[model samples]
Target: MISDTLIPDTSMTETNTDKDHIKATMKDAILKAAEKVFSDYGFEGASFRAISELCGAKRALILYHFKSKDALWKAVAEDVKTRFLTQFSAYYHEAELKTDLQKSRQLNVAFLKAARDVPEYGRIILHEGLTPNERIKWMSQELKPELVTMPDLQDPFLIEASLSGLIRHMQAGALLYLGSMGPLIAMDTEDADTLLSDASIEQFADYFQAITLARMDQLKQLEEMQKEQVEE
Candidate 1:
């Protein structure tokens, strides 16, 4: 006689799904708490114990989601990056942004909004730049490569200069602006997303955009000059 076949358990399936959801929820909570802890303490300074406590999660549970402190830190960074990208994407493809300046301005505003949405963002950025370390390198190269961009140029010197100017203007301005007139805007305010403010941040943002656009135009002009030279 054949042995009785085991019947499928619907309750067991529901239980598994619930466990998966809880794991996801805990992971999100862990990342949220980790962002603050890492931003306040920096990578070397942040500890898993503090992160677990801040999220009100068990240390072992957090570790079950993220095996190492570095992994946890990266998860927090990824979470912030995801939020930034979500906001950035809104302006990245605006139908009415006819020029690069317009696009950049909108993108910059998105940056400000992202900073406000995630207040820990600016401090984390500042911490990353205080030294030439792996964290910043990972961010620049892997986590969010599109954070920096420039128009086509083949010259090594021009490329370096453009990259430097981008950092000094766009990226640097983002951090500075958020720290300066930034705190004034209520994260929940209706006007927080108006893209310009009375704090003169529009001028600050505009100046940086102009510097970057001028550099881009200069690079494009050189490309034209090279083409003309080839014809001659």
Candidate 2:
């Protein structure tokens, strides 16, 4: 019969808990570093070595956490999706939006904040839009069904296109090509940096919401005019 108190159950539990905490920390660090690298260099351009360098972790450790680059990309995409949904859900419930347009604006605001909070999300999306694959399809499958059910998001395609296109273009102009376009836009390095600041993102979100609502109102007016003509 072995002595059960040799190491003590409490000691064993503490050791296991420490290991679990370390593993979780390392995994989180790797995911964060991978997001920055993937955003800078799309899926094809990103490398495990680059991510390891960024996180100051060994390549073997990263591989241990995530089997391969594809697996890592999938993980990051899932994280982005989760963050967006979580933020939107929280804001929707907390805000208690009354009308469809109000809900739309609130959701849009939540999305912009999520994109800003997760810097890699927009870059990853732009990359997917340029070179779509099964991953993109998977993302669409995950998001589209939920999006279509929203009262203000019934026409998911049009809303997605309009919002994504705006974000992509703004990201490219403000972040990706800032070095080149900064001078032309009369923006110094500091000014360019401000483009991605929280205040700027909020401003952009408000502008986007206003334009979207205005467009919807215009469409409604046009439809009513067409109905009048038909009745006449």
Candidate 3:
């Protein structure tokens, strides 16, 4: 007995679209607020109430988007990962990377920009590093594998010089240098708000890439000599 006019109209579709857009916007805001909170206080010290206040959203809304604190933390981690990979590919081709050393250097450069772009990712890592927990385990599984590295090799004397996992260690340095900028906002720095300005990023990248390449070359030579002695 229903009339044909009873069917859904464009008005209803438009309303639904508007609601979806609002939901996405609210969620993104919550995530942005959470990134700052978690980066500052870390997972243990971070809370929904703080994120809610920071985002100006109700606590209930944050809960609706992320069921628990753990869920929210994991979501943030995933978001950071997506942002990094997205930025890394924004310019060049990954396939174009030739040597493992070159790939590692490029990755460090990429991380420099990625961390500078968001900065929260680097801060989160430093904070998380201070405390080992289930989160780190999850990261090792979900996040660490996203990047490539050289072969499995190490020498105690050449740990900092070796290409094997060089990206990992350099990232630690990068995190300290790049991640600590948020706190440095209070201390007067050049004209810009942070050292992550476009020109500064390029200059720092050039310096890091050059030094890292030299150290890796030295370590490679030492490794070759060790191999020669073993053969003799």
Candidate that scores best on TM-score: 3
Indicate whether candidate 2 or candidate 3 has the larger TM-score: 3
Per-candidate TM vs. native?
0.67, 0.65, 0.71
Comparing candidate 1 with candidate 3, which one achieves the higher TM-score?
3
Residues 9-39, candidate 1: write the lDDT tens digits: 2245557677777667667777777887888
Clashing pairs for predicted structure model 3, backbone only: none
List model 3 lDDT by residue over 15-110, tens digit each: 767777767777778888888799889999897788877777778888899888889888998898788767765532443666655554565566
lDDT of 2 by residue, 1-232 (tens): 1122211222345576677776777788788788878877888889888887767667888889998888998888778667756765665566777665566656555655555555565677667657757777875676443442243545543365345454334434433332234334536445656755657656766775676656666666777899999999
CA shift of 55, model 3, Å: 3.0
Q: Which candidate would rank higher by lDDT, 1 or 2?
A: 1
Poorest stretch of ten by lDDT in candidate 2: 1-10
Q: Sort the predicted structures by TM-score, highest score first.
A: 3, 1, 2
Task: Report model 1's TM-score to 2 decimal places.
Answer: 0.67
User: Model 3 misses residue 70 by how many Å?
Assistant: 0.6
Ranking by lDDT: 3, 1, 2
Please give the CA lDDT of all the candidate structures: 0.65, 0.63, 0.68
Distance from true location, Cα of 14 in model 1, Å? 8.8
Better of 2 and 3 by lDDT: 3
